[model samples]
Target: MDRRGHGVARHRDLSRTHYRNGVALSHETGSHETGSHETGSHDTSPQALTSVLAASAAGARAFARTTSEERSGMLHAIAAALDAHAEELVPLARAETHLPEPRLQGELKRTSFQARLIGDRLRQGLLADVRIDHADPGWPMGPRPDIRRTAVPLGPVLVFAAGNFPFAFSVAGGDSVSALAAGCPVVVKAHPGHPRLSRRTAEVVAAALREAGAPEGVFALIEGVASGVAAVQDPRVRAVAFTGSLRGGRHLFDLACARDEPIPFYGELGSTNPVVITPSAWRSRAEEVARGLAASFTLGSGQFCTKPGIVLVPDASALIAALPPVHSGPMLTPGLTDGFRKSLDELSGTPGVEVALVGEPLEEGVPAPVVLRTTAATVLAAPRVLELECFGPSTLLVEYAREDEVYEVVGALRGQLTATVQAGPDDDELALALVPLLAEHAGRVLWNDWPTGVTVSDAQQHGGPYPASTAPATTSVGTAAVARFLRPVAFQNLPDAALPAELRDGASGPRLVDGHLKTPS
Candidate 1:
């Protein structure tokens, strides 16, 4: 039966795939309770999970043998498939996530664009990062043997989908796509927030890969917390990619590490992106800064990993008055709502914290924008309390008496996805001082801008130190994200026939020969 329309066929498509373990299971497998939104799904049993991981391990070797052109074609196919199903996917996502139609549509576009962008780069040989050093009789350090180096796949990877941006971070999101581009088979652990959406999206992806002639087991989607944990501990799984809270990510990170053969666990956990306003900048454009802050902190109900959780300004009295009131809608999940309320209550009860703007009391699931104020000294004294994340449409305003206090507050911040500085021409000294300090704690540093909208490009860095992400040197966005699944290997003194095509003599790719960058025709 064709898996296209809204009817019994759709429902069958949902249950047809037994690979919920990695490979398809028989139709007789017992059903497992998925969630309130999604029912009649089988929780991947331990036996099935092992079979799935083994298939992915086998698929990884077959996928690695595929030429870059073949991989690029697979990516293009996935992107086109996503675009074709937008009408069906966008509504399903909105229903499950409660996100507005425009937001869901835009996110779907961004997700597909990421796939195509990586495809374009792969064909250009940019993703491989090839390098060659020819043998030299006389060299600076001594005779250097002929060495050819290129990145290769790290086998199977397990990805944990994020909750907030279902399309951009779930199922066929950046992590899954990037790993596939690097020739590694991927198994995405679906997020509970949008299980139905996850299942449907996985159907589209699996079909696209099959049509594109990708090897079997190149991609799969598994449900249930047990499946995720078991996948992490499985020896066949080589690496893990995750996006979620600090507690959850940390727990998984530990599990991945405890494996007999520990694998690399790349987790984008939590971030309290802080924005600094120099005295001169605040005086010059208080209202403009205030408006930007209000919109940014409330974007996506402040659930973005890069949301500015804390903002430091010179005068609370002037800035507070200029700030416009903001109201946020319901969050994505009931669990998220409960966590938001708990975090807000803790901050509100803190002795030094005072309410600056409280639009409306939060109802059971609906969240309202809130702004709290406290002195820089209080934050400095109790960094544990003031400098934590409150994942909602709220920001803690830390009033600094002098420019020196701004430095102290930034210095005390945890690893962050982003750090912003609002400055004017007259505040050059302060901006220069803060930029370097912010760089130490954040993956991406911004100047006179908010950190809400992250661009998908080669230069973009979406991961930071420790709490922001497990792997700081790598990124979870942009073309570079593929690097997380690729490990470098050097071939020394290999004959032309034995060397990989990109490293062979007269090869075509972007590479360095004798320490000089070269791009072939």
Candidate 2:
């Protein structure tokens, strides 16, 4: 115990009362340096939780009522503030996550870029997804009533910040930004792995939104597992956005579904992003593919959810030989480190799987990369062990004799965030056949690029089926993610005065008028 008091770290949270109470308790107990992990328990009273939810609901009301221009202004302000605070933030992120400065800086940049991107989308009012149908006096089904529809906010949203992406998936991450842009008040459940950074980031975001004239509670930050569970359970929370593991996200999904008034839980879960290499492709650019695989898998100590976990290769011999030494930096947390070790053991213990290249040993908290070899037959027989996401810098290489075997392996896959197929120019027919199969199993299918780098753009799809994400039809990244927090509302034969602005004729967003595409005038 140091003399500075463990209360200092707890004070970083947005809850001032709790901070003071924690400090007093620490002093009373004669504790010194207990750390935030010990004293950071933000078990707020049920009344306080309800109050937070109430404020969020009020904020949602205001947010939904605000014009698209207003929301965009706030989003742009948030982007600018993130950039202003980058110097202060990246270091804290690096200290907490053990990620290098350059990577964290890029991530912070991406985080801000994502926010601004949403703002730009909002300016166009594309997410409104408006439609209008003028009443026809001589319609086939008699006289038809004027029908207009546009999406509206789903009210308060609870976002579960992810640990691996300290900046991009943390407090100012995609989920929260999308929810906010969709006009839903965000209550981010700070990831404990980077609580200090989460709190700081939250402060930055809150200030930005507030300065941009966002209503109180438009953005709120809360900590602790209990708080997160309670936020999801709260009736005011209309929908949720989550990004993490299958177990963690599924648990929250279950809670949301079990509620009396069930809400949509958009959870981006685990993925064993598989990359299949054709025999021809391997022969043509084997070294290039090998190096890219190594870089993608080991990027960020393989902490990325999209880190390729399984590589179905025609031949593992060359790729195995090309694999770099198993050296890697520390994982995001000690718990993840242990989980990765257990997964490594499970794969190593499996009957059909063979250890091709074992990485060099490292100190605790840092995992050595591992590569396992198997066949398409082995994978089909024991898909559970082989297909399951290991969540670290290790991958399984499955050898296939025929292209049909590749199809079989792809068939065995559950939903995935991404599936990559490297086909030589001559293997076009095979790729054409396989792309469709891969599309059925994954949200995003790449021809030659790795899935590790998810671009924040209009076209990006960062969600997939089942274990990859609970809501396959929805994305948790990119401009499309705003749809998760918005539900469609139709006004039939409504008076001119009652029509929403976006649904009114000549609105500034893409629309479908009488079942025909109409650009905003």
lDDT to native, each model? 0.82, 0.79
**What tens-digit string does per-residue lDDT give for candidate 2 at 406-508?**
8888888999999998887854677778888999999999987898989988988988889888999998889998889889889999877788888766566
For candidate 1, write residues 1-521 as lDDT tens digits.
Answer: 00000011111122333544233332323333222244454455666677778778878888998988889999999999999999999999988877899999999999999999999999889998898999997988999899999989999999988878899988989999999999999998877678778888998998999889999888887766667877899888999998887777788899999988899999988888888988878767788899999889988888888889888888887877888778788777766766777888888888899888876533554877888899899999989763568887889888999888988888788888999999977547888788989999999999989999998999999989888999899999999999999999999999999987888898787999989999876
Top-TM-score structure, candidate number: 1
List runs of model 1 lying over 4 Å from the truth. 1-36, 39-42, 360-365
TM per model? 0.93, 0.91
Models, CA RMSD each:
5.4, 5.0
